[model samples]
Target: MSEQPKPLPLVISPPRRREKPPRHLADLTLEERQERAAELGLPAFRAKQVSAHYFERLTDDAEQMTDLPAGQRVEIVQGFLPGLMTSLRTMQADRGTTVKTLWKLFDGALVESVLMRYTDRATICISSQAGCAMACPFCATGQGGLQRNMSTAEIVHQVVVGARAMARGEVAGGPGRLSNVVFMGMGEPLANYKAVIGAVRRLTDPAPHGLGLSARHVTVSTVGLVPRIKQLADEGIPVTLALSLHAPDDELRNELVPINTHFSVAETVDAAKEYFDKTGRRVSIEYAMMRDINDQAWRADLLADVLNERGRGWVHVNLIPLNPTPGSKWTASDPADEREFVRRLEAKGISTTVRDTRGDEIDAACGQLAATES
Candidate 1:
């Protein structure tokens, strides 16, 4: 008799022997930076100086760091800010308000970030991993499988570069501050929890120690990493949590998000609610509106019931227009269907909003450009 096929594992552990990224200052805390400087035979004060130039002044170029002594400037910058990534390609859309950059990491892994400028704020959606292991069939990054978990510095550098562009007015609109960061670019952020949390700390830490962005402005999205969601709630940081719950029922979600098979819909939603209860930060439920797949009007009502079952005013649904990949079967839901889905959710008192789909011309869907390059 043929044995039944074994079920797939929930987490795809990173393959062995992947080369680690170069160590950078952003990977270290302020005190650790001082200790490293001492080991380099440089005074402790130099650490703060270089951090000021990089974090406060938004420059990583050693030449621009005139405050450091000429002899030690190169050593300090090289010791701490060794080049991490270089732009392989950049595309602009939305009348230049949205700039997407494809960055080649030191190990030749490619990841992308999109800097979006709005009337009131500038937000950069950054990648947490070079590729994803979540294996969401509709996602480009997940199809590519796991490359390697990104180093803490690699993740944070994306934001710093975007911030620099905004400060210099390189990304359309006048010089402005980067007010928000979203971990919705390429990978399941919580799967790389330690590094993601470190990056978050660096982002919210004060200038000279970090970028100093407010914790409230940071949002980390995961594909229902239930245990990690609970762990994040315990952490004092109150960054918003976004659960990419494409379907509200186990039958559909198991196929849509394979991880759901291990952690069922009820378990995932419960953890998300616990996060909200602990942090007092409302959770955002991400639903990709797929044509004839998970976007039916009934699923909207079911999703509303799923959330309302937990409690009132604890979650909001952000509907994403499915950005179909090249030659893929998945596509965005029809306008009428999308509108009706929204109406259904709102009718049940679930605050909902359709995500502003941008940069289709620039291959803005996560990992599309990188997949093309590969």
Candidate 2:
């Protein structure tokens, strides 16, 4: 039997604040944008135009939004977008197809975003917070500690930035649109529930107000925040919910994912089932495969049993290959063990896949670059 890894540092999550983040137009609704426009002495329609440029056009540069008054372009851009975060560095992989960017927020907090372009579709992995509060021992970001909940605008900005880069032919595939988004980056999204939902709206709502992407294409991941999961289901948004259920049993989960103490494995899976019922989207169980730690064949069977008990076809296991942080005792499981784990789950009639860990040289795992840089 293998010993459980040492418990990592944890942050007691404070209550989510109702206070709004610093001003950026992406944070505002159409009505709010109009109100702010009037207050800024710009015409109400001007707000819509700026939004079209940002959301519809995916470009914040005043020069590109040339239909607007030439002199006023700069003014509106400054007042609305204002460039909330600056790109400190960008590292690429896969022949410049996979790009990871490290952004410095206005307050100097660091977060990361990754853009992966394939032949058929492009996906961008975005961070919901500067750092994470959920102390998942194997996660690099969780180990670092939570910095602050990213604003709705801050979250949307990452998508817009990635989209803009794609449109600019910066990536290998010349000028394409970002088709999918995964909240699998830095923070536990549900921990910052309100802003993440707002970001979802900003990403999926129709043009002039949002990027107009489909809700089905968007995925919001959580560390099993039960109430928030229920709240999100009621929101009528059917974005895919990915639960970070790293372990299937409460005892090991309690040690691997400290939040399991608050929401047990049984209750967490129950919440996930509820989400699937409400949204009609299958819940993704994200289990990070670690060497000699929670990666045994029996654990995989138990995971399948748990999901099967919930019912088949409502849950899919996404086995994420762990990217161990520097000097970490835990590491990814061996290929043979990983294959066997997958076989056990499939034999139980549970769908499973070993996720593609892209951007290896660029530190693909969340918070690695920022954690190292900071």
Candidate number achieving the greatest TM-score relative to the actual structure: 1
True-structure lDDT of candidate 2: 0.89
Q: How far is candidate 2 from the true structure (C-alpha RMSD, Å)?
A: 2.6
Instruction: State TM-scores per candidate.
Output: 0.98, 0.95
Candidate 2 per-residue C-alpha lDDT over 1-374 given as tens digits, one digit per residue, 9 for 90 to 100: 23544543334454454444568888999999999899889889999999999998888889998888898889888888886889999999999999999999887889999999998989999999878878777789988888789999999999999988888899997998899999989998988887899999999999989998899999999888888889999999889999989889988888888778778899999999999998789989999999988899999989999889888899989999888888898899999999999999999999889998788888988999998998
Any runs in candidate 1 off by more than 4 Å, and if so which?
1-6
lDDT of candidate 1? 0.92
lDDT of each: 0.92, 0.89
- Candidate 2 deviant stretches above 4 angstroms: 1-21
Clashes of 1: 0
Candidate 2 similarity to native, TM-score: 0.95
